[model samples]
Target: MALTQEEIRKIITPLLLSGAKMLDRHCPRCGSPMFELNGRVFCPVCEYREKQKKTETGDVEKILKEKLNELASSLPEEIDELEKHLRVMEKIIELLERYKKLEGVK
Candidate 1:
């Protein structure tokens, strides 16, 4: 079985970027490294005679990062609103305490 172009990309791109020493030559079909076994240049990463790929890949990590950034941007506003509510509740508690103190002597 031959690997698809996407499979070749997933395996090779990271290795190249990390500057790993390549032992095999790149495949003519998908640009992935091909290993030679028994004097045969067989590609385990891509089908032979394959053309340029037209498939679209998803960037899930990028989308998640953007969503996190949006959530972080709104967090300060949420914290501010909570702080305002806490201050109001504190004032109400203080007023109730004062009313109770006045009633104690009446």
Candidate 2:
């Protein structure tokens, strides 16, 4: 039921190549013909727009990493809270177990 990596690649490569050719024939941004530059896709006018968009939002991965670092720094405090909550839960479970034993029910 599962495809091997090689088999998946074999099936996907033609589709990818075809899609690239189609994209070269038709631009994704404006539905105009795409001009290839050094094997990279570019629509001259859209390129400036894309750059502006990037400037507006910056790199996604870098932003994600900065957020992740902020969260990671807070994790020790969160873990301490979680451990306290877990201890409370364990106490509740022990009381339930003792109640069941007193009731002579399994």
Candidate 3:
């Protein structure tokens, strides 16, 4: 859905206040102006949600990898406990791989 001018203002005001820079580029989907925040450029009306989803997905991937690394470093000497830890790490690895594949689809 295309955003009305007032809707765009509602979204852009806080971004501008927070130091988001208005860009010369326009959104291909909506023809609205784009802004850059923390090096990510997007349209408040069009691409903002897409950008946010990508950023959130990236965060989740990072967190899963970190957890897997932590589990790897904490492996137990006891065979039973080691198996449990390996199972958890395997799940995390699977999640990370799934996310990587989803990103490729995008």
Candidate 4:
């Protein structure tokens, strides 16, 4: 007996969703290869799911620029700390010179 169209569809639907494409990677749970669905990894057989691929997500240059800006914004605090350290060193140097004079040491 020939299968009805609805019966064929019911059978084929699941197979199509689970079919492995050439671009598919691997299933996170079963170690079987995974297929791509809407840019995310999908393992139809095992029902595994991975979120969108990382490489497909963001602008590299924009990310770099944001990091650089973060670094740049923190520079003043670092410079202030270095300048405070320099002042302490100058005070130590002055005291050393005074001690040398008192001891008649060059």
Candidate 5:
């Protein structure tokens, strides 16, 4: 069956609000509650890892550096994917804004 615009919004609005609440609620790591620190949401334990010193041997550092360079070489592809996603999101936002304007809602 075909759905009306009001029906579609009634079905989607709650789901979107719930999803946003869930995304805003959790830590990316450990799935614990995140606290805002210095304008970033982070798990307290995960943030503490930044203070730990690396203890790599010469051989380990050499291997790590090689792996890092390999990963760095792939960054352009990663950046392209992010740019594509951002473009898609921008289009979605524009469409939503137009819909809201038509609906006479802010």
Candidate 6:
């Protein structure tokens, strides 16, 4: 069903009141303007959720790398504590690699 302009406005009003941003990009399905709210990008008219931009992933990857470096430099002397630290470092490396792969695609 096609929503009237009034219906669209009704849907968007609360978001705007709560500080959701109206984005410049339009929806592929309905061509209605998209919005960004609480880090989520979506089209209110079509109710379609958009994937977050790759730049956001890049930022996450950088933070994980920095944390991994910090953990490495502060390694614990105890074997059990060292093992726990190594496990966390491994997870961070895994996340960094995953983000790198995602950035390669569209």
Candidate 5, residue 83: Cα displacement in angstroms equals: 0.0
**For model 1, where is the 10-residue window of minimal lDDT?**
49-58
Off by over 4 Å in 6: 1-52
Q: What is the per-residue lDDT of model 2 for residues 11-88, given as tens digits with 9 covering 90 to 100? A: 435445665432437545555445454577665445545555555444443554465455445544567886765565
Return whichever of 2 and 5 wins on TM-score.
Answer: 2
Worst lDDT window (10 residues) for model 5?
Answer: 49-58
Estimate TM-scores for all models.
0.28, 0.28, 0.63, 0.26, 0.27, 0.53
Q: Give the TM-score of candidate 3.
A: 0.63
lDDT of 4 by residue, 1-106 (tens): 2334563355435556666353446545655545565566555544311122223223443454465555445554577885765565566556555554644531
Total colliding residue pairs, candidate 5? 0
Query: Highest TM-score, which number?
Result: 3
Candidate 6, residues 1-47: lDDT per residue as tens digits?
A: 45576757677787789899999998787777789999999887665
RMSD of each: 21.7, 19.8, 6.0, 22.0, 21.2, 8.9
Cα error, candidate 3, residue 40 (Å): 17
All candidates in order of lDDT, best leading? 3, 6, 1, 2, 4, 5
Worst 10 residues of 6 by lDDT: 46-55
Best by lDDT: 3
Q: How accurate locally is residue 32 in candidate 3, as Cα lDDT from 0 to 100?
A: 74
* Pick by lDDT: 3 or 5, better one: 3
Q: What shift in Å separates residue 54 of candidate 3 from its native position after superposition?
A: 0.5
Error at 74, model 2, angstroms = 2.6
Clash totals in order? 0, 0, 0, 0, 0, 0
